[model samples]
Target: LAIAHQYVTQGGLDYAREILESALGPRKAKEILEKVQQTIRTTGFNLLENVDPKQIVNFIQKEHPQTIALLLAHMEPKNAAPIVSALPQELQVDVATRIATMESISPETLDQVEEVLVSQIKSLFGGDVSEIGGVKAVAEMLNSVDRGAEKNILGNLERENPELATEIKNLMFVFEDVLLLDDRSMQRVLKEIDTKDLSMALKGASEELQEKFFRNMSSRAAEMIREDMEFMGPIRLKDVEEVQQRIVDVIRRLEEDGEIIISGRGGDEDIVV
Candidate 1:
């Protein structure tokens, strides 16, 4: 009650948890947490290898059996669904089928394990959410009611980066773009976007996003963009916008199934295909 009151008064859960971790759980939770911390300290950075796997394994063995089983089954899935979620449809099908076959678990047990796992996941995710910047930050951009549903997990990490926010605004292509061309025509158009345009685009993109674009583009086209960027003279945004649009249109036509992002001269220069 006092901790809850303090949290209400202070407007945060951190303080409350800190007080409790320090004040309560001396025999069980506190001792366990302290021992874990001490182990990590003794092991230093290389401690991952030295750390006993049974700490986790034992936790499962000694805890309520139902909670133990659920924790084992889900593990990282409790928070990293976005990264694992996009496994090829075949893999998704297989995993989903296997997971579905497990005996049903009690809701109360599931909830108990979930509360702790969710907290751990938030801490794990929060580190990523805090360190990433530029285009690499797309995880947080997605909306998820819970950690498991977050589609843009990468964007959450991006919340700290102004540059990443801009890159995300740049890569917003859609899947319905296949209607843009037949396969043969798409190949031809893909060849037309020179390295110059890509390099220009890269100037505004995150390294990961830039690599995705380059991988999708033809080698010749990528090289051409490079040449263009090299030979291209510095010019006004008006000229750049015109060229950028043409390049993006070509990329869109080539991809056939996705949008090509083109950076325009206007303040809203980021165009999504």
Candidate 2:
């Protein structure tokens, strides 16, 4: 709970931690709250004059019974509950004494807290899967890694800091992974291109690949392309845009394979003969 308070103070209270807590199995959430707050508190500072540990322990021990109950629930029932159970006789008596004198909590407050937890949980975990790290990162990380290992990492990430992990997943698209299209969709896509330019764009590309493109194209257009290959010349800039739009996904695949070179905008002096 102290760590959680520190997290809110540092990160401006986007309610990320609360949402994280909701997702954790009671124990893990408690662990993550402590871990994340530790990360935030130590992020920018070195050690300073130590405050009294007794004060820290007392603050938690002497809080209102209801508040302490809620806070301990934030902790894992295993470790935290045991500590609460084993509290010094005086502290337990003090908390019970306080609880006996307290007024009843309003039902409205419980409703509000439940609503906040639900809304925040969805917001924190919500994500767009399409934009994950460039195909490179996921593939690299998963190499030789098992699904169970990945699951554990993702679960821990979701608990402590979900926003960052969601962003990582969106920015990557390892290999031709649907990232491109399923093999069936590739057939429909090849149908949309002019075979001659397709073949030329594919020049130095593989025979099997060229055939893949042609087989998917309209037969008459494929014939026209076979006859007109010679007439096609260096791609015009205006046409490059049009042409590139047609093959960008394919080019990305080719680029990934290290099979083609693509020049970029540069001054005349930077261009080689």
Candidate 3:
């Protein structure tokens, strides 16, 4: 008895649970088995460390709300938001509510959730994947969606769960995120933008962002844009958004190619090489 107790304690609760399962029967040991397996998968290996967010979306769609919520909780919000937005309307609120309110889930429950994903992931490709949602993940996802879908998801989230909404918004980068770029990167982006598109994009921009753009340009160019904006009268919101999205696309491409760094998306570090 002493030796068994020592082995259980030394091996950890998971190992102990596996031993007990043999006597408890499969039905009674199901929950314990789940915890043991989940711990092994997550801690023993990076099974889903950097898997695409879309893959996560596929998995969560078929899961129970509680299970989905648990998985999302573990993921970055950026990755989770798109999944939430893409969900069938009826499930959105329920799953989101669970995310906002979920707390202190047992290892057994988490194991059960991870088990479902692990099995599906194994069947799909038979290898380790990346972790899911985070603030950055949600931000990146929002950056890709249409404005209307973005707005609706955030609106519903704000109503159903204000706290999570605020957190996600802070993480996201919209047209206004341009202001966050350092001067050099900002200038690089400016060089690629057409005057007309810039004018249209700024039609609905806040004075602060406009000032940021002006501050980054030659005085003459600033004066010219100011003049253009003043006369650009009554532009459609959709047009402004389209041009803004275009500018955002340019910035994203530049960032992807290592041409420029956008602050707060984790690229602020000084690379020695």
Candidate 4:
């Protein structure tokens, strides 16, 4: 029992002392347990404080599912949730089950796991690991650039990594995403964006999105826009994309300023307000 208590305490389980005290009724043991757990929590979270969730997921994906489960069990829910969700679907169930069934991890084992994670994070920054690229990062980057640039970059990324490019495109909020916006938010964004930019942006937009925009406008205004788009024939794809990106930038700014709400990508809640 003394060895068990020592293991529990060293493992940073605050409840270890509680269990010990229940049987032994020792106050000093409880105090020591509290301190140990506090130290572990502080140190562990600090190690991951600057690490991105994607990097963590990538690092752990190479580990055993049980090991991944154990590591996540020690992490904050906020940090762990996305990593878990981002994991391959088949592994998610296995890892989640492992975490649920996990009882106790030896302190030495925990330390090893932490050391591996920390080292992996260092490797990522040291360029030992492939740079972390994700749909969210790509979409956010494209949102800031001209359409032509966005297309060129995405085209290159696609040729090199088709899967990644596809994922990024799925995450990106195109002119089509405007159709998903609430009417009020759409109106709010439309009010802020220049009509010319909107017209050019709509040139490449889906018909559904174009009609949604028309429906939101007065009939006369909608007719004027349609006429303008028709008369502005043979526009370059680059110019269309550039103007579209400009409109997207406006919507992004509106969303950022809290004037409009942009729904999240990949069927998720907005990660950032």
| Predicted model with the maximum TM-score | 3
Q: For candidate 1, lDDT tens digit of each residue in 22-103?
A: 6774354344444443333222212222324444443334444334323323333323233224333333223322332335
lDDT-superior candidate, 2 or 4? 4
Error of 1 at 47 (Å): 13
lDDT of 4 by residue, 104-162 (tens): 45555555665666665552111111112234543554444333344455566667667
- Candidate number with greatest lDDT: 3
lDDT of 2 at 109: 43
The sequence of per-residue lDDT tens digits that candidate 3 reaches over residues 90-139 is 67656655655555555455455555566667622111223333445555
Cα lDDT of model 2 by residue, 1-273, tens digit: 565665577664456566556776657666666555444433311111132324434645654455543333222222232333345544433332232233434434434443543352221111111122222333233222233333444444556556644543333232223223434545645655565556555543446655555565678966766555556655555554444344655544453353433332012233354
Q: Model 4 — TM-score against the truth?
A: 0.42
TM-score of each: 0.25, 0.25, 0.44, 0.42
Off by over 4 Å in 3: 1-69, 73-137, 140-172, 267-270
- Give me the overall lDDT of model 1: 0.39
The better candidate by lDDT, 1 or 4, is 4
| Global lDDT scores for all candidate models | 0.39, 0.42, 0.66, 0.63
Error of 1 at 159 (Å): 22
Model 2 spans with C-alpha error above 4 angstroms: 1-183, 191-199, 233-246, 249-273
Residue 115, model 3: lDDT of 59
